[model samples]
Target: MVREFKLPDVGEGLTEAEIVSWLVEPGDTVAEDQPVAEVETDKAVVEVPAPVNGTVKEILAEEGEMVPVGTVIITFDVEGEVPEPEAEAEPEAEPAEPDGKEAADGEPAEPKDVEATSGRVFAAPSARRLARELGVSIEAVDGSGPGGRVTEADVREAAETSAGEEATEEAAADADSGLKSATRKVTDDADEDEPSTDTDGAEAAGAASETVESADRERTLAAPSTRKLAEEKGVDLDAVPTEQTQDGEPFVTDDQVREYAEAQQQAQAADAEAVSGGAEAPAGGPDIEAGGEDERIPYRGIRKTIGKQMERSKYTAPHVTHHDDVDVTRLVETRGRLKEKAEARDTKLTYMPFVVKAIVAALKEYPVLNSQLDEDNEEIVLKGEYNIGVATATDAGLMVPVIKGADRKGMLDIADEMRDLIEKARDRSIAREEMQGGTFSITNFGAIGGEYATPIINYPETAILGLGAIKDRPRVVEREAQGASDGANGEAVSKEVVPRKVMTLSLSIDHRVIDGAEAAQFVNTVKEYLENPELLLLE
Candidate 1:
């Protein structure tokens, strides 16, 4: 009999999954529990196994197509019984409206034909689900079910039996567990006073307890951002105490977490030092050197996105970058005053807010810079509103969190949102949604000391601006003395480039979405604002 294998509920309330690939095809003989396909849900890639030992009759879903839970994915002919056509034919339907009565009331519908009995023993819904995972035919096992019913144990035993058959004499002969196999025997010596309900309850508790204990060794609990932070801080997963308890409450404070992380780094360094001293080497073993191999990890996350984007922009957008040094001596001094004024208002003023203001002003003059090429539709998408993406580097990878409706927000709001987004990115709290839908991107690599770099364009967006470190350098300046010929101020000052502060800017753009002329003009516009400083606050 050919049995239809509908997609089972793979827990986690998964609603749908995308078929990643198929391992078995029609006419291929597969054992019960052999993987037939891989499906990718939002969480992970899960293997879907055959439920019956049979030849695959058909595949119902194609690769990469999303299928809902309970959707049939494959069919198999386990026993090779072809029912007579008459037996398989659908029963005659009642007249429309079923003689004027709505369907599914007191009149019971005909039972759907069952190609295979659920071969499970001692079944709770969860146990039945687990049995399906173990690939054991519920029918083949002894039922310890409520009334001679099979349970998870029967399913597991069946799996182990099959697995044992594949091993060599030694390993198989020595009682062993097979691929999540375990045995549970329900004893008849139960206390007579124990309630009937308690019997099933005890079995479930045992199963759950075993599962939790085993999973503890393999998995650790923490928020995604917390994990990222731990990695960046070099905190070993095993050594870090769980901040959360079984009741799912956090007990550790952020300060305590940070301190613990720092301690771990110190301990690791001490261990390395001790090893180098030959104190920790195996007795009489050759001394192994510590830590010298260099590795080039491919830029991932935000960095990777930045790279692809810039490459596309440079090659496709016809990029022409115009460079001109700006004289921001007076602008720098003005910024100091603004900072003091902002401090009085309990708002911190950073150079970025000024740059953002400038960019906004320029966008009004040149909207073409904020457009994307819809190559498939052969059209350009000129965004009417601005949602800027700010490139942030976290320990795990780079992230570009967007500031939606950026053009509509005031400088203070923009600054606050930018601060919040970057912090979240660094902490790994930013979601995938927060990382997309930007008409433009700005990467401030200057904080890390680079003067200027040709930043890659953030795809879908025409360009990305890379800001470099601001440093001080000497320049010709007029020094005033009694209105006579004066020498330039040779000392360091905020406004004057007196060997104290200089900044660099790099802009990567998609050549296809933007022209070289347009890119240059945009950069020039930004430079003008940075140079003048005063223009950043136009009332």
Candidate 2:
């Protein structure tokens, strides 16, 4: 039976999705839970898995095409009929036809057949280029690679053996002339202690030796460029062995030839330097065009979803922003001291966990900032549970994954969850629900070297907090000291400016549900927790 697979909603309120690519084709076998297609939803890119193990029958959705949810995207054929088994049994009943012995050339001598290696052969792109340069037909080479794919070694072997056969025939046709020309040289090298062996035996031995050398020379396979390089460097291609081989013949590639040439140059340069008492000149870089101009990128996939989300957020929310600076000297000290302890518990303690905890606590103090506006009902709905969304910057765009029950988790647990969620978001594997149920959000532009940004509110959420880069700056503090009054009233007080760690904070809120006063108070609460990290322990 054939079953159709539909595209399901992978994200919250997702109506349609774009098919990024199809990984399976008709006649390809697939397993249950194996990914058959990659689809981009409104929030993230996700893989659609196969529901049953079967052969892919058809693909209905083309790559980059947007289709609505619940539409059939692919079809499969499960547990095909018994006709294949019957055919196999028929071949076994007729056992007299042995393919191996049917032809004297080891394989079927006939060219065209059902199982002929003449149509096409799978090969890497680089392998195909080498075969073309060597004038070898890749389709006719016997592939030893997995699934009968023709590799570069296969092509090189075909070229070498073909060249060898031609050389052997030429030597055979000119045997008499070659023997006469080498007569004097053979006599000079004959063993005098062996009584100057018979001229007939010497001629036969010499001919046999020449044939053997020619056959041995034919066993080495190399591409045309590599052959030329070996010749220019005065290196014998057959002397340089390679791990990659086809039919037990050593195949040389471009890299192997270059490596041999480089070694030779280095040795020669060293010898020259020793003799002349000076070093060789270094190589120069190539002269290429400066810029990568004329490049255009298609705006689709995750970028498309991010653009839509940004537009919706900007148009839907009337935003108000507030900025302030905080002294995080104490927070830095606390983290430095407790870092080893946090590592002992098998977790990394970062500023984000502290920020998340502070935001959750501030939401408790100012519940209005954490509430959502129900425009259809004309009511403000305050959520009791804290699911804080942490905005992370990724290669694609921004992603806000929520921390479920953030108010109930401790700093270490929150840090672990935030780390995992941030990684998943960057890798585009986070589940759709993980980005939902947020009452508030936070963006740390500080991590990317920004002092502050007017972060747009994550739609439906009332507020978002932006963190700036922390740096050392001068700060004024008040202290009481005896007889330290400034030349005025008799109040003994001292004020001095000293260097301290400082950070900038920005808060953007939905003006409909939150007022400027409420946003300020919420930020003040967060400042209190950050400046005095001890307050978090009490909470």
Candidate 3:
């Protein structure tokens, strides 16, 4: 039986993706669920998996071609049975030549099919044809593709260096430029669009900088990445033009600097050749192989969802962070005492339960902190009830599973509920509903060993609190002491400073919905409860 593999909806009603590369080609056998192609969407690169085990009968799209969702990307001939489309696939192959031949080169000749089905390309088709006529495999030529997809560019580039473009191709292939090469090309274009401020001796000589003017103009401005790129590329920043905007900001653009530096390097290389009569090639030239093999996977599925949410939260919320430290010694002792009782009551007691309890109390006292900013209504929706979300780190990503009505649950109940939610999250068993509708969120990065972090506010919710690691530290205290000499028959009493457990609490709140004073007060309230865990019972 034959099957057609359609691009399933990656996520979020996304409609199309650009075919970056194919992992398999026609005639290659593949297994079900095996990754066959890498597609690039607007946000990320995604691996497209095969739907069924079969031999590829046809490839419907070319690398760098864009296809709509549900489009047939490949056809499979199961059990060595060729699909009927194999006969029809000729038309698909023949039409591409008449279409792209002109754009690739000035002349139209018999175009060799340049299929990168298995991700190997070595030379330009013309070069390949030339090599084939000369009885050579183009593979002998170095590839400049991401994985060294041998390109006309790489062939021409290699040809210029020496007669042995073959050796350079291997060396270049070993150096893998892929994304770095593409980025460099973009950088070159970007450089022309913007000029760098750091000019070299030639640039300085051309511009004729005076002692008085150069000294006065030094502090005013620069291109964004020009100085940095110049330093990396060995181009002096002072020699490049500063007439580029760094994203509308007054700084330099990376392109402007890089272009200037590249030109300077080329000039310096020529000068070196003239002086040393072909001295060990100048310091830096194209290392088109510096970027390791980069598979361009499309941003789809869970990562795509995360990107949207983060962008929304970052743009929509005016976030403010507040920090405070609390001595958790008393709370630690209280938890130790409550553990047995909690277990007897069928509740697994932990420090988080105490923290959750304290948060519930604080929310009740400061209702505004437990509110959401409703953009549609132009008002703040103060949640009369507490639906606390505990951010759980999962393999998919970070998910906040909420336990609604946290105010109603006792510490033990909260602990049990939290355990269930966390377990479900880790197992990827958390339902969509359970992960949504959170009024507020708390992340315990302290478990991950961080003293402070400015957490991004969970969207719509006003605040998020990050807990830091707890550690023992010296604390000062007053104590009464009696001398042994004062009571010969009695014993001497002494007091001294002691080390106690301390924890840091960092709270990030939406300043638009919460004020600095309110955020500070909330932190102080949480600190007070943490310092004295017994007060949790009063709630």
lDDT of each residue in 468-499, candidate 1, tens digit only: 77767677554433544324554433333345
**lDDT per residue (tens digit) for residues 454-513 in model 3:** 999889899999999999888875455655333544555555689999998889998888
Q: Write the residue-wise lDDT of candidate 2 on 1-539 in tens digits.
A: 67778888877678768788888876789999999998987677799999988887657655655666886767677755322321232211111133433445343343232123545456544456666676565556786544565656566666666655664455445543434322322344645564422335334344434432211353465544466566666666765545666435566665555455544444443344334333223448465688843433445556877787778888998889999988999999999999999999999999888888888889999999888989899999998889999998888788899999998999999989999999999988888889989999999999978997899988888889999999999999878889798778788999989999999999999998899999999999999999999999976
The global C-alpha lDDT for each of the candidates, from Candidate 1 onward, is: 0.59, 0.73, 0.65
List where candidate 1 sits over 4 angstroms from the true fold. Answer: 1-127, 130-331, 431-433, 478-497
Question: Which 10-residue window in model 3 sums to the lowest lDDT?
Answer: 207-216
User: Which residue runs of candidate 2 sit more than 4 Å off their true CA positions?
Assistant: 1-16, 19-29, 56-75, 80-295, 479-483, 486-493
Global lDDT of model 1: 0.59
Which scores higher on lDDT, 1 or 2?
A: 2
Q: What is the Cα-based TM-score of model 2?
A: 0.58
In candidate 3, clashing pairs total 29
